[model samples]
Target: MGLRYSNKINKIRTFALSLVFIGILIMYIGIFFRQYPIIMVICMILGLLAVIGSTVVYFFIGMLSTKAIPVTCPSCEKPTKVLGRVDACMHCDQPLTMDRSLEGHDFDESYNSKKHSKTKA
Candidate 1:
């Protein structure tokens, strides 16, 4: 199968959502350890931490998204946010870039790295 690309913001959001689900699953599993109060409590605490971590991640991503550059996707003609030098269109998954020099080149996420930019210069 070919490599699949998705918007960075969407990917992060999905990860956060998965974290929430995982946290819930862990809490559910803890229910089976009712006889062992220590184990159950441990599991419950871990699950709570995971859920809290997900909330933090969501908040961080939301803030970053607000600062992202807004642009209309050429392929979809829909407004989307670009998180870095290179990102996929949220609506159409079209490869995008903010730098003219990098245009037409392969879409590489490394372009967003400071080391890459220094090397290019």
Candidate 2:
């Protein structure tokens, strides 16, 4: 199979959305434990927490979007936000990098890590 790639911000947003669905599913499951009030309550609370956490994550991503670098994706010819040193274009999921030295190199997420950069230096 080919490598699956997507915009980092989009990926995080998708995760947050999935968390909301999972939280709702968990809460629904809790309804079956009507005889065990404690278990049901606990499950409901956990589910609520997950949903709330997802909201917080969504908000955080919004704040981060403002700070992300804006660039035109060569492959897509569309403007997109880059979250880190390396990121995919939001429009086309085209891999991109801000570092000229890494230009034309394979898309490696590790390039953003300090350990990997230090080793190269």
Candidate 3:
């Protein structure tokens, strides 16, 4: 397939990592605004919020883990978690689906957009 699909857990992990990096960058920027204590404080708070948000996201992932379907990836021969109706193998990035109807279809991220599905239905 032309489309590349990544594991849902991996995607969330990447998002968490980006949030952390962005938080640090924002906090660093606040250092440059030392002359304006108020702006610096606000920046610091915002940066803290980002980091905290990432923490919450991480927690949410943990909660999702309990609900994820555990399956062995055929391509990677590794155990992975499949979230929702469609997900990819965490180790090998192999597209997987719980729905039989979606089987053999080209992997598309749009499948995850329920609004798109609703409109089509």
For each candidate, the alpha-carbon lDDT, in order, equals: 0.92, 0.90, 0.86
User: By how many angstroms RMSD does model 2 differ from the true structure?
Assistant: 1.7
The prediction achieving the highest lDDT against the true structure is: 1
What C-alpha lDDT, on a 0 to 100 scale, does residue 9 get in candidate 3?
A: 81
CA lDDT, candidate 3, residue 117? 64
Clashes of 3: 0
Name the 10 consecutive residues with the lowest summed lDDT in model 1. Answer: 1-10
lDDT of 1 by residue, 1-121 (tens): 5556799999999999999999999998999999999999998999998999999999999999999999999999999999988999998889999888898998888889998788766
* Residue pairs in candidate 2 whose N, alpha carbon or C atoms collide under 3 angstroms: none
Candidates 1 and 3, the one with greater lDDT: 1
What overall lDDT, based on C-alpha atoms, would model 2 receive against the true structure?
Answer: 0.90
Q: Worst ten-residue run, lDDT, model 3?
A: 112-121
lDDT, candidate 3, 1-121, per-residue tens = 5667788888887898889889988999999999999999998999999999899889888898888999999887999998887888888788998777788888776777887467544
Candidate 2 lDDT tens digits, 1-121:
5675788899889999999999998899899999999999998998999899899999999999999999999987989998878888898778888888888889999888998678765
Output the number of the TM-score-best candidate.
1
